[model samples]
Target: MKLISWNVNGLRAVVKKDFAEIFKELDADVFSIQETKLQEGQIDLELAGYHQYFFYAQKKGYSGTAVFTKQEPISFKQGLDIEEFDDEGRTITLEFPDFYLINSYTPNSQPKLKRIDYRMRYDDALRAYMLKLSADKPVVLCGDLNVAHEEIDLKNPKSNHKNPGFSDQERNKFTELLDSGFIDSFRSLHPDEAKYSWWSYRFNARKNNAGWRIDYFVVSQNGKDLISNADILNDVYGSDHCPIELDLDIKGE
Candidate 1:
């Protein structure tokens, strides 16, 4: 199964940039999206062979996430089952006959770490949710997780030290999650490759290839063998962040 994840930055804006063509070109079996920045009924996508599901934040045009899959899931749910976390509509869980897929848009700590506390809570909550699901069956987690876990993850780690997405606290939280029996799919395969998934729109970051490898496809350790391929599609463009692809050997059944 070919699964892909991307933080479009803004779904509406990207759609205007020929997102339909791009989507058709990628042709993912499951396309998970983050930072949709829209509410229900804001846009209509005519993806003939896909079933689209979206979780919109309570606040208009803010944080949101979506998933489009060619096969129908046995069950699906929105949120992490926490009221505050559910408010921003950052997660969607789909249950297939074989495993569970969690598409997430992790909260940013914001400038100067203003929202660090909230972000930490989000990380903890999400980790717990993943752990809970993993206890029952293997889980596939994907999306823009916000933090760049290691020095090799960002183009300039020293300069970005303690920044919202590069702080020690944020990085530790990511470490903790992985320690709780998960695998960072991309880094596992391309250990030393400096390919990045997200870049700043400012300072011509994308043009210069100055970016962070924040978007991910994390699998439960139990399902690690299911990963067939993981890659960063730096060549595709529609938003500040590029699309990430993860291929698995399993099917919906």
Candidate 2:
């Protein structure tokens, strides 16, 4: 099975940038998108062959996520049970026959670290949610997690240490998530690959290859053996963030 995740930044903007063509070309069995920044009746996307699921934030034109899958899931969940955290519409969980696929657009620690405390709380709640789902079956967690996990994850980790996404606290939360029972699929497959999935739109960062590997596809330990390949499609264009792909062999599992 093939699954792909991307933070399109904005759904409407990317649609005008040939997102439909890219989607057709990739033909992933399941494609998840984050940061859609749209609400109901805003834009109509004609993804013919895929079943679409969207979770929109209470706030208009803000954080949101969507999932398009060729194989319809057995069940779908919008958010964690916590009402406070669910307001942002950051998560969508799909329960397939084999596993749970979670598409998330993690909250960013905003300018001046103003939202750091809230972001940390989000991390705790999200981790607990994933763990609970994992107890039932393996979980495939994917999307823009908004954090550069380690020095190897960004081109200039030293300078970014104090930055919102690269702060020690955020990175450590990611580390703890992996240590709990998940495998960062791309890192497991390409241990030394330095290419990134996201680049700052400022200062010609993308052109200079100054980027951060903030997007990810993480699977529970039980699903690790089924991972066949993981790839970062840095060459693909339209958004500041690129798509990350994961292939799994689930026939035997």
Candidate 3:
């Protein structure tokens, strides 16, 4: 199965770009999106041969997520069920016959670590949530997790040590998550590679390849062997973030 996860920054904005063409080009079996930045009754996307599931934030034009899949899931859940977190529409869990596919848009810890506390709480909650789901079946969690996990994850990790995504607090949480029986798909496949999925728009960052590997395809340890390939599609562009792809040996079901 071919899976894709991208932080479009804004669904409406990227639509103005060549989103349609890119979507068609990738042709993912399951295409997960983050930071949709839309409300109900917003722009309607006509993606043929796909089932669309959207979870919009309570606040209009804010954080949101969506999934377009060629295979219809047995069932789908829209939120984490935590009142505060659910308000932002951060996650969507789709239950297939074999596993649970979760699409998420993690909350960012703003500059100066202003929201670090809340971000930490969110990390813990999401960790517990994934663990719970893993107990039943393997879970495939994909999206912009909003953290540059290790020193190698970002271009200049030394300078960004205390920054939001590269902060020690966030990085440790990621380690904890992996210890709790999850595998960072990309890292598992390409151990020494330093590819990135998100780049800052300023200072010609993309041109210089100064970016952060924030987006991810995290799979439960129980399902690690299913992953065939994990990659960062740096050449594709629409938002500040590029799309990450994961191929699994999972048969069509």
| Order of quality (lDDT) | 1, 3, 2
lDDT by residue for model 1 (55-128), tens: 99999999999999998999999999899999999999999777899999999999999999999999999999
Cα lDDT of model 2 by residue, 1-253, tens digit = 9999999999999999989999999999999999999999898889898999999999998999999999999999998877766888999999998889999899899988899998998899889988998999899999999999978999998887879999989999999999999999999888987879999899999999999999999999988787999999999999999999999888853
TM-scores for all predictions? 0.98, 0.98, 0.98
* Model 2 pairs whose backbones collide: none
The all-Cα superposition gives candidate 2 an RMSD in Å to the true structure of 1.2
Worst 10 residues of 1 by lDDT: 244-253
lDDT of 3: 0.94
Provide backbone clash counts, one per model: 0, 0, 0
Span of ten consecutive residues with least summed lDDT in model 2: 79-88
lDDT string for model 3 (1-253, tens) is 9999999999999999999999999999999999999998898999999999999999989999999999999999999899889999999999988889999899999999999998888889999999999999999999999999988899998888889999889999999999999999999989999999999999999999999999999999989878899999999999999999999898752
In candidate 1, stretches whose alpha carbon ends up further than 4 angstroms from where it belongs are 251-253
Name every residue pair that clashes in candidate 3. none
lDDT of 3 at 30: 95
What TM-score does candidate 1 get on C-alpha atoms? 0.98
State which candidate, 2 or 3, has the greater TM-score.
3
Clashes of 1: 0
lDDT of each: 0.94, 0.92, 0.94
